[model samples]
Target chain A: MSTTEPKRRGRRPNGADTKEALLTAAREVFAEQGYDAATVRAIASSAGVDPAMVNHWFGGKEGLFTAAVQIPINPAEIVREVLEGPREQIGERIIRRFVTVWDGVGGGQFAALIRSVAGNEQAVTMLREFVQNVLFNRLVKVLGVDHPEMRVALCGSQLIGLGMARYVVRIDPLASADADAVAATIGPNLQHYLTGDLQLLA
Target chain B: MSTTEPKRRGRRPNGADTKEALLTAAREVFAEQGYDAATVRAIASSAGVDPAMVNHWFGGKEGLFTAAVQIPINPAEIVREVLEGPREQIGERIIRRFVTVWDGVGGGQFAALIRSVAGNEQAVTMLREFVQNVLFNRLVKVLGVDHPEMRVALCGSQLIGLGMARYVVRIDPLASADADAVAATIGPNLQHYLTGDLQLLA
Candidate 1:
C-alpha cells in the first residue's frame, strides 16, 4: 500500500509530455484570461492533467507561469556581445540586436503579449516580471555603465515603445517599414539611455 | 396623416440631451465592445433613445466614436505655443503639456479606452484612427523638425511608452511617482526626439 500509493501520488503518468502540455495550455490560458483571472483548475483542465501535478512540477501558479512565458535569455549574453564591440558603437549594436529579437520572433508573440497587458492583471504582472527579471536584470549586468539599472529601465522603455508602434498598434509606415530603418532611427536614443549624461534639469 | 407624422421628422424631440446621452453611452459601449461590435441600436438603448438618432447627430458610427473619446485640443493652439518658445525647448514643453493632460484626465477613461483594444477588431481600427487622425496629426504641426511627420511619429512612440510605463503598467517608482518627477526624468529624451541631431549614430 505504501509503495503503490506513494508512486501514484507523486508521479505523472507521462512526466515530460505532461509538463509540455501544461506549458502549452498555460500559454493559451494566460494569453486568453490573463495572469490574474486564470486559475490552476482551468489550466489543468486544459492540459488534462491533475492539479497536484502542477504543484509537483512547478511549485504553483506563478512558477507555472514563469515556466510558460519566461524567455530563457541571458542578459549577460547580450551585454557581452554589446560590450565586445567598440564602446562607441554600442548604441547601434544594442538597437539592432533588439530589433533582431522582436523581428526574429515574428512580432506576433511579443505583440500579443504587449497588447494583452492593458486588459489583464496577471498578464501585466507576468509582463513586468519578464521585463524586470529576464530582460532588464540581464542588461544591467552586461553594460557596466554608471547607473546601469536606471539606464536599463530607460532603455527598456524605448524598446517597448518601438514594439508598440512597429507591432502592437501597427502604426503604418513605421509598422510596415523595414527593420534596418527602425534600428538606425532609434539606436542612438537607447545608447544615450545607457551612457549619456542626462542631467535631470537638462 | 402628414400632421400626425410631422413630429417624427422634426428636430429631435429633446435634441441636446439625447446627443449628450448618446455620447456618454457611445464611450462606454465603445470602451467595452469597441467600435464594430458596438451597435447603434445598443448605444441607443443605453441612451434610452432611437438608433436613428446616432446617424442624425454624428453621421455614423465613425463620427459617434470621434465624439466619444475625442480630447478637444486645438493643434494650432499647441503648435503656436511651441513655435513661440525657443525652438530647442519645444520638446520639453510638449512633454510637460502632454503629461498635464493625462494627469488632468486622471487615467481612468483613457486607460480603459486603451485597454479595450484586446480581442476586439473594431476597437483596433478605432484606436488607429484616433492615434493617426486625432493624436499624431496634431503633434506633427508642433514638432517643426526637419522631417516633421516622421519626428512626430517617433515622438508618439516615446510618449506612448511613457504612458504605458507610468499609467497602464504602473511600473516601479514611476507609477506612484509624482508627475513632476516623471516629466523631469523622461522629458529630455522626448525633447531630443523632437529636435535633437538626427545624425547622431548609435
Candidate 2:
C-alpha cells in the first residue's frame, strides 16, 4: 500500500497465506476427526500443501492444534514439562507452569480463551481435547492411575478453575498470589485428584 | 390482553411490574454498593415501592441479589444450609448441593451463567460478590478459617471449574457421575480448601 516502502522479503507474502490455509484446513480436519485421529498429513493435504509444511509451519500436530485454537501455550511442551518432574510434585509443577505461562503473557490471553470457550461449542470441544487428549491423557498414561477419566476431568476442572479465579474473575489474594503461593495452596489438592484414593468415590 | 385468559389472578395486575422493577433496582444497587453493603430497603425505594416489597417478592437481601443476577439458586438458603451442616462434612454438602441445584434445573442454567459471566463485566462483579460477600463470607465467619480470603477464592475456583466440567463441557465420567460420586470424589479437596491447614498458602 505504501509505494515508498521496501518490497516484501523472500517468500514472506505468500507464507502467511499458506499458514492461514493450513490453519483453516487444520480446524476442519481436527473438528471432524478430533485430536487423536486428525493427522498432520491429512491437514496438509487438505490445505493443498505438502505434508512437510505441517512440520515447517507448526513444528507438529500439537503446535498446529494450539495455533488453530489460538491457545497461548503449546500442549506438547507443557505436557512434556509436566511429566518431566517427580510424581509427588506434579501438581505443584502444573500450578507453577500455568501461573508462569499465563502471567508471562499477562492475563488477557486466558480471559479471551474462557470467553471463546463459553461462547463457542467448537472452542469447548477444543478445550476438552486439549485437556483429555492432549494434556492429562499423557499424564494419566504415565501415572497408570485408577479412574483415569475421573482424574483427567478433575484435573481439568481445578486448573481451569484456577485460571478463572486468577485471570478472569481476578479474585484475591489468589489473584495477587505468586506462582509458588498458588502451587502451595492448590497443588496438593491437584495431586490428590491426580493420584489419590477413590474408595469413597465408588 | 387475551379475552380467553382467566382474570389474571389476584394482585396479578402489577405484581410482575413490581418484581421487574425490584430486579432492575437490585442490579444497580448491588452493582454500585456490592452484596454486603447493599440494603433491601434501598433497592425497594429505588424501585419506588414499599420496603416490605423486597421481602414479599424476593424473600430477603440474598434473594433479591440472586434475582437481580438471574442466578438460578437462592444464595441465602444455600448459605444457610451449608452453614447448618457439621464443619467436617461441609465440603461434601457443598458438592452435593451444587450438583443438585444445577442438575435440578438441567445443565442450561450453569452454562448460561458461565456465558453471561464470560460476556459481561457486571456479571463478573456480581459473581465475585456472591462468592466473597455472600457465600464464603458467612462460612469463613462461622468457621474462623485461616487465610479466609484465599480459601474463599480457592473454593470459588474449584466449584466454578467443577460446574464447567460437569455442566458446560460435560467431561465424563465426572460429568455423568451422580451427586454422591461427585461429592465423594471432590469433597475432600473442597474440605481441604475450606478448613485444612493453609500454612504454605502464605
TM-scores for chain B, listed for all candidates = 0.75, 0.68
Residue-by-residue lDDT tens digits, candidate 2, A1-202:
7767565575577878889999888767765554555788899999998888788888888778778765556877887888885889898899899998889768766776676667566678878888888888888988899889889999999998899889888889999999999998899999999988964543
The candidate that wins on lDDT is 2
Candidate 1 stretches with Cα past 4 Å from truth are: A1-18, A21-56, A59-62, A72-76, A88-90, A141-153, B1-14, B28-52, B59-62, B72-76, B137-149, B177-180, B199-202
lDDT tens digits, residue span B1-202, model 1: 4546565466565788899999988877876764556889999999999999899999988778767766534545666675576766666676676666677767655565566555555666666666667665666554555756556567767776776766676666555556565666677777776777655333
Q: What lDDT does each candidate get?
A: 0.69, 0.81
TM-score of each: 0.77, 0.72
Pairs of colliding residues, candidate 1: A35-A122, A35-A123, A36-A122
Quote model 2's TM-score.
0.72
Off by over 4 Å in 2: A1-71, B1-71
Tens digit of lDDT per residue, candidate 2, span B107-197? 7667766766665676788788878887888788788877889899999999989999998777988899999999988989999999998
Worst 10 residues of 1 chain A by lDDT: A1-10
